[model samples]
Target: MSAVPGTVQTVGLFAGQHVLAELEGVDPALLDDEPFLRRTLAEVLDLAGATVCDVISKQFEPQGVTVLALLSESHASVHTYPERGALFVDVFTCGTRAKPERAVELLTEALRPTSAQVQTINRGEAEAPADGHREGAS
Candidate 1:
């Protein structure tokens, strides 16, 4: 929605997908490998139709790893808990340039989680108020 001359746009116009995944029984060693995680994340981004601009991964001293991919459309990330044999993943992309679900799928394959729970959300779907009133405004 476009802003009128004197009124403000009370909602967003862009459409994006956000995928949240909870993984269990993952391989602890895989979650601690920075290089492997980075490469795998890059491949996942490519498979999801996202252009990867850059990637950052970190490994904790005791255990676990975190990988973040900065995509042209948006960002994808993974946080691992090797001790718990679990991980949390988030993939968000704007427009139709990428598929967040595909990314999560690939991650599930690479991590080999025994059980997984995924939640997908459609962002920026609210209709803008013609009267220029926000959602909570009376």
Candidate 2:
């Protein structure tokens, strides 16, 4: 039974976690240092159990930096605003091998922001109801 062109095939269930953080009142110098930011991200991912594949970064004129790490589990990134002393950090990992939340936490620690806003998102299949209760059998 094989008769299809551009058909969708089931590939089991998928699950992943995404962690986002907004760090404020950080040191502008740290935010503009591309090399240090890249190294920090790589080390953070490793400590969070993520395998680093490749890293790419750019240093902006005036002041700013963006560092991205491609990971075996998924990927992680950081975008900085040196003028404002703030940065946005994101770490996402597929499957259960890595901890995205820990990555964010470690990032927060490394940056030492005056304040941090963090959010955790559960992605992929088999999510519970939004109201936090399973539907009764019908």
Assess every candidate by TM-score.
0.80, 0.82
lDDT value, residue 114 of candidate 1: 94
Model 1 lDDT on a 0 to 1 scale: 0.88
Count clashes in each candidate, considering only residues at least 3 apart in sequence or on different chains: 0, 0
The list of candidate 1 runs beyond 4 A from truth reads 1-13, 126-138
Best by TM-score: 2
TM-score of 1: 0.80
Residues 1-138, candidate 1, lDDT per residue (tens digit)? Answer: 556787776433477899999999988888778899899999988998998999998889888899999988889999989898899999999877689999999889988999999999999755557988768767
In model 1, the clashing pairs are none
For all candidates in order, the CA lDDT equals 0.88, 0.90
Residue-level lDDT of model 2, residues 1-138, one tens digit each, is 225776766433388999999999999999999999999999989999999999999999988999999998889999999999999999999878789999889888999999999999999856457776756734
**lDDT of model number 2:** 0.90
